[model samples]
Target: MATALSEEELDNEDYYSLLNVRREASSEELKAAYRRLCMLYHPDKHRDPELKSQAERLFNLVHQAYEVLSDPQTRAIYDIYGKRGLEMEGWEVVERRRTPAEIREEFERLQREREERRLQQRTNPKFSSRGIRPGLTTVLARNLDKNTVGYLQWRWGIQSAMNTSIVRDTKTSHFTVALQLGIPHSFALISYQHKFQDDDQTRVKGSLKAGFFGTVVEYGAERKISRHSVLGAAVSVGVPQGVSLKVKLNRASQTYFFPIHLTDQLLPSAMFYATVGPLVVYFAMHRLIIKPYLRAQKEKELEKQRESAATDVLQKKQEAESAVRLMQESVRRIIEAEESRMGLIIVNAWYGKFVNDKSRKSEKVKVIDVTVPLQCLVKDSKLILTEASKAGLPGFYDPCVGEEKNLKVLYQFRGVLHQVMVLDSEALRIPKQSHRIDTDG
Candidate 1:
């Protein structure tokens, strides 16, 4: 089992490379990978006692990496800042309150813990928990489709509430029942009933119904096309409401036509020839009511557009303010950088593992080191790697952008290893290692 560490502690790069797979790997693939690494690095495989210890150490590190990346929420955090980003809260919270040094410290602490476990795995394989559990759902429904005249729906799910209604009009009274099973990825249900009005005073009349009423099925999908934006599609059937309007926007582009009626009857026998769905409004006279309503609708649409634009403007303003604040924080960190001149230099690096057994008979070990520098590194009280080094380092690439970073550091100050986690832009000085009387020393 991997111990829990707050977002305030962990190394970002070790978090990413720790898993030994690309960021785009699927959840299942990630599991397979963890399993494979555990098998390969299990301490039992090492022939030499010392090598066995190394294998055990790396195994635990591998286990910790899998424990994090296997979980969706934790993986998201790791994806952002490698192992270090886990110190910060989940995706929604950014640690603007912490200093750069503080964030770095958090990341460093996580990194050290991971490394320590990596060292420990050499002899023992603690494969108790990988930090993943299966999630499930169930649904029941009948008459979920839509008809030209109106709607029919049925659905049931545990995550939703049940609803029932009865109404009595001048002509008839009927009961309606509805249930929504889940939120978003859940199930749904609906039911309908009908009863005739008094039959003694009028011509013969009957009511007929087969299933529920007014239910539509919908789903949304998204694909990323660029850095700052994404492509998405919404599919649905039924009455328009809430997110259902997304489908209406696509339907609006189609052509429309209505059927002609010549006979007098309570219900028209006319058909519609619209590209999408039918429009029931009839005649130039009916256009009168529709005209005013259309005008009012246009006004409403304009009002909505105005409101949306205002909201967009407000959102942009807020974003701009946040950007400015970050810039200020960056400047402050730079100023503070002058003090922690010789701190631990953290670098994010990436390298592709290549199996080049050219001999085809003997195993080979080849590790190409790639250093990625996005932030400055503190080493021995002097800034060795400046931010400018970021531009020159290969593979110092950031696996995730638009994510907060927290860093923790654990190292021996005198003779004992201590841990410190920091949020991005936060700072911490390593406590001086205490010297104790040692016969060996």
Candidate 2:
């Protein structure tokens, strides 16, 4: 029986190519080739630091290849299964043939181990923390009179913890420094603002500010009314005590505000005002003209997504049925060939199913029977020469970007069983000799 192997050990390295020798080279020839390559790539032969580093890496790979190919038992395993076969611990040669079920169980076990390892890596603190990012922003604006103002801001991560500096020069010179901390739900800020006027009335004004607030220096509270609307209020107490009430309706892009101010005197006098005459007209136009247009667009997008999902489901079902029909016909032909004394027999094969990208919410995958393609290839060499598009198999769709496609095959040759894995069907060629070694004997 074959032993368990780790996913990392399932490599496709060509040991013979590394040693510059043929696949059928004898043990002596393997050793001689290893020695020659080892001497040429040995780190000790290089003096430059970068060159030495590269040489050391090459030397390590060469050493590992030689170690496996030099041992008689391991070499036999390598000849069939390549790197993955030797990786199986306690693996031993057996006289009995392995069944398809047993081979499939072994593959499933390796897949489970790989998934576990991936989850562990994702949850590791060091790995998760590597995503923290830093950013900087600067903005400058000028009027027709050439009065200019600008600000520089720096932020860390996605939170409100940031630093900002502002400078302005017009009829007055203004400079401000601000710092914010904590998150958007609850945050605080400290700011210092200074303004200097140079005219008939030369005046200097400044304020030292501190608040648990929103934005750079405004203290406010807001509530989301719906998917697109909000209501909020802010109050600033200073020489001119002020109170502001804001309402955003229809969509957040449009807003209306009411401001009330009180003078700090013995008899406090209050004044109320609104600067939304033009904005009132704008909002009216938006509601009457833009809202319906935007709503229609949103509905169209949703309908498109639903149609796309339905189409994908239909396509997959049809493909699966077609693949099954093709497989049945191919199997019949293979049976006829075998009865006529042709040297071909059915083995094991696996084909994964295609899934809708929109419906893929997890890592689970579904596979179907694909032993038919392998069976057909055995009888007609021309079958292996077809394009990837016309390989006449089901579930051979190109994976979405960032995803990988793989095919696993098991076959018997010369009374010996073998297994192989192909990464993608981009090149629908027969499995090469390098992929024909049986890792699980």
TM-score of each: 0.21, 0.26
Report lDDT per candidate: 0.37, 0.47
Top lDDT hit = 2
What is the clash count for each candidate, in the order shown? Answer: 67, 2
Instruction: Name the Cα RMSD for model 1.
Output: 26.7
- lDDT per residue for candidate 2 within 1-441, as digits (tens), equals 111223332235556654545556788987876775566567786676866765676678778988887766566666656688766766654212444345445656786566545533332211012355534433322222223222333344555343333333333343334443334433233433233332113223333455454232233333333346544444344333343323333355776766544344222222122223324554685578656665675566545544444555455445444434434544676667664653445577655433568756532444445676456445442224222321223323222211344566676544445576554434344434565665664
Give the per-residue Cα lDDT of candidate 2 at 318.
56
Worst 10 residues of 2 by lDDT: 121-130
Residue pairs clashing, model 2 = 80-437, 81-437
By TM-score, the best candidate is 2
User: Residue 249: error of model 1 in Å?
Assistant: 52
